[model samples]
Target: MIALERPDDPEAFFEHAAALLAEGIAPEHVSWSGGESADLFAAATRAPRAKWRGEKLFAAALLHRAENRFSLVYRALWRAARAKGWLGNPADPDLCALRKLEGEVRRDSHKMRALVRFREIRDAEGERFIAWYEPSHFTLRANADFFAHRFANMRWSIVTPDLSAHYDGEVRFAPGGSRRDVPAEDARDEDWRTYYAAIFNPARLNLAAMQSHLPKKFWRNLPEARVIPTLARAAQNRAEAMIAAPPTAPRFSRASAPQTEAAATDLADLRAQLACCEKCPLHREATQVVCGAGPLNAQLMIVAEQPGDHEDLAGSPLIGPAGKIFDEALRRTGCDREKIYVTNAVKHFKFTLKGKRRIHAKPGAGEIDACSSWLHREIEIVRPKVIVAMGATALRGLTGQILAVRESRGKMFDLAEDRRLLTTTHPAYLLRLQDEQEKRLAWRAFLSDLAQAHAMAQA
Candidate 1:
């Protein structure tokens, strides 16, 4: 094997790799070392250079914390030289490895930037800031410019175990040192630590989540980490105390007081009242009021758009071709249609007479607003744990917001009385799609949204 030695960084690795590639040396024949072994290719030395794009890729991939990262990068470079757009092909093993490394390095660099805390130190040059951090990757040199740009007005120094960066006006690097090199205590550290401790809510304590972000490896450098154990030990007691205290009055308790009695009254009487409703002009042309059907104590409530031609004649909701798609989706999600409450945003069909047939028409904002009263009353009666709002009109009816189906599909929003509203495309919308592939994809997505609602309802 052709043994080679270079600096322990991406730039150095790329430079050496580029030189070796120019020399027509294959990756399989090469045995690389990052300052650990003597160079056997001393006689094969040449000027090291790479393309701009290649250099950029190396810069990002170098930040990875993998042990054999250099070898993987070299393999990727070897393939890249032979084929154009090699990196774009994710099926390539080398390219995939490089991309994975890039992601890890990017996260590592972000954490280093967020977690670093500066301490004030006095020297011959007056006041200066110093911070010590330990990163998972060799990202100190790559991230040094961030500190220089952020603290351009102040003189600062950041020391890591593998590297050190100092910035007065310009950034410069020096050899890495030990934790003893940094001051253990600072005057302002206690004040910030006390402030953080005071604001920490014990009731919201999630130890696993907290540890995932601010890991145990980084705890030694953080001032707030000193009290983590004490706070964690007392979290249960503090949370119990908070729960034992009397509940505070809601913000709109008085404003919503009068409606509570009305909400508790009979729902059948409410449906009877809706039969003669003329709040909107849609009630005039429709055959009859299509009230919601299903179990009274259903955990899942599916709200669809306005009634179609078949549904309008049948005096029911979700009974046409679109209903077939919905039933299939419900079956795929293991949800029983008989056990779930089904309703429409508008009780009337709102369709245009096309020759002898009635063609479906979209409900107007005024119609949806007028119909919300009945929808809200159904919610108060059924009291579903999860409400699935299919299509834009259904969402507008429930939430008073006309967001696009693509924007809010499969996302849950909090409604009044602890009910969650999940937005998704209507089964009717699926039937209207022209492309077979797109229709199939949309059908799958619709089923996925139904599954989410099913899971939420069960929970």
Candidate 2:
């Protein structure tokens, strides 16, 4: 057995693991600190350097958190060097554990950035800001540059249990200390509290969600910690007052909202009526009305749940990440997208604002019912021989009944006017999966559904 000194940090572990690999030491035969003593290759290494194929950053982050990181990383390095495509395999037990470590490290880093509160202090350097944080992992150094770039004009120092990072014009790391090292408060905290109160929206109060993001562990460090309870308690009253005083701007709907349905003769005319649809309240918040795109006389009609962020802005359906997945599936199945018509169940994009980003909100039952007319008209105009409903939302829109997509996928149901409806998993569903094997299985199932639909359309 080869005895090696254990690496303490991520960088040291990376270097040691690489050197061990270069010396051609098998992972099982090498011992970092303690292991059973009986190996065939007894001493100095003779094997040539195995070429590394795996990402170093991937191993580095996990090494900082895992309990048996030395063994785990060395085994990963050994397989990654000799075996082709070993790095891409998520089915490996070590890779699965590494992924979990990556998530925890990522969350810890985000919390370090968000919850670290700095207090102004005076010393020989005039005035400087100092903050103390206790992270779950060794994330203090990783997030140091974020603070440096965000508050470049000010001199700040962050001290954690493991290490300390200081930034004047350049960043420097030092030894860490306890929470008592940082001061309690600064005059700027009052300003922070005032700004938090000004932007607090009482109407959208979700206490559970707030607690999930700003957990109990971070409450003591926050300037607005005491004010959160006060604001939450008075949210109902404040929301009522805001509703009564909201004459600043009338919702910008057309003076004469279109009297949807029966006025449309063709696809173009139906789209014109759909533009000013006020039948649903979702129209009030959306950017613009998105409608179907493709040939009017196509034999196959594809229906998705609704427009995403990109589709909302561009006024076209399936034009973002979901679109790329769908395009690839079409290519695999030998189906031409241009020959098929595509549209959504709901014309408007429904989302909630997070900072400046609009997160996609699932359409409720009432919203789906309101938009059913536009889809009804679309079906009448196009009159495709076969309709493929991607996901349960599209399925519900067609039948007006809630049915599980998984239970009914790849099965054909006869519809009115000599048309057929086929159920399938959405391209968006495939995007949510993290495991490589699961993604591959889901892709195959999705492709099979599309291929079946295409064949039925041709027949």
Clashes of each: 0, 0
- What C-alpha lDDT values do all the predictions have? 0.80, 0.80
Candidate 1 regions off by >4 Å? 1-9, 39-55, 65-67, 84-91, 198-204, 240-459
Q: What tens digits encode model 2's per-residue C-alpha lDDT throughout 73-150?
A: 678778877898897998999887777777777887888888888999988978899998878777877777899899
Estimated TM-score per prediction?
Answer: 0.51, 0.49
- After superposition, which runs of candidate 2 have C-alpha atoms over 4 Å from their true positions? 1-8, 30-54, 237-459
Give model 2's TM-score versus the native structure.
0.49
> Candidate 1, 61: how far from true, in Å?
2.3
